[model samples]
Target: MRLFHFSEECSIERFVPRVKANRTNMPPVVWAIDEEHEFTFFFPRKCPRIVYTRSEGLTEADNHLFFGLTSCNIVITVETGWYDRIKKVSIYRYELPAESFQLFDETAGYYISTETITPLSVQTLTNPLDLLMARDIEVRFTSNLHPLREAILQSSLTDFGIHQFNQASAQ
Candidate 1:
């Protein structure tokens, strides 16, 4: 599969990881990042659908899955394959604009612009097929202000103020 971030000038790169299946063949699956941690899993050929989530309790539609440049607001397009048959497959594309999100977060506050890339792998097959599913996927978000960033910096400053006060009391 090919992924392009508009902020990256639509440069497509391979995000799927190399795998060894039965010492010869390999399969494709979905890849994503959760809480700054990387995860790879297999996608079923029949369904070939995967949803990524930032929080644990969110549903598939509620998940914040954005794609774009890492820092700027730019649109992105993703093209992947869909299963048509065991030997034949079809391609589907999805396009999202950078201005789609109203908010984003880096530390605690949300930003308007961000990008993330991940690799993917696959396991288990109902039948021996050479179909390529979306094994790896990248998500980029573009926004004006990041809520997470604000939260982290604010917490850091609060802790620093407390530490300074403690030092003065000791003296």
Candidate 2:
């Protein structure tokens, strides 16, 4: 499988999960197969697309061709048909140690059902109880209801990397 991630930053050796408590802040790092997706850019007005490949993590491949410090063991792949999720959210999350991927699918019930949340306040709430737990929440992102989008915009971090992606080859 050859997946892609487009980003403004040049470095992505370590896949870090969005740690803030929100819809898209859960484990695994986000990546995409398409470049035109709406969420590709962090700063749409000033960002450039830097491309990464799964081959960077593959051995027996030329080191010069690999773009960054990606390792073979940490790349996490999602099951097929989940591609739409990537398009809708702009990118998909890939958790390392792999089993953590299910925490997204299995724990959907715990997410809040509304985006009316104060974007600024979401950053301050430190307790899980403050999020108001649920049991079976299915998330769908509409233009206005994107907390993850707000989170990204609100974040102070400089690296807004969006890796380009394609279906992982069945090697």
lDDT of each: 0.25, 0.27
Give the lowest summed-lDDT range of ten residues in model 1.
158-167
List the lowest-lDDT window of 10 residues for candidate 2: 113-122
Whole-model lDDT, model 1: 0.25
Task: State the TM-score for model 1.
Answer: 0.17
For 20-47, candidate 2 gives per-residue lDDT tens digits of 3333544434322221222222222222
Q: Model 2 reaches what TM-score against the true structure?
A: 0.20
lDDT for position 81 in model 1:
30
Give candidate 1 regions above 4 Å deviation.
Answer: 1-86, 102-171
Candidate number of the best TM-score: 2
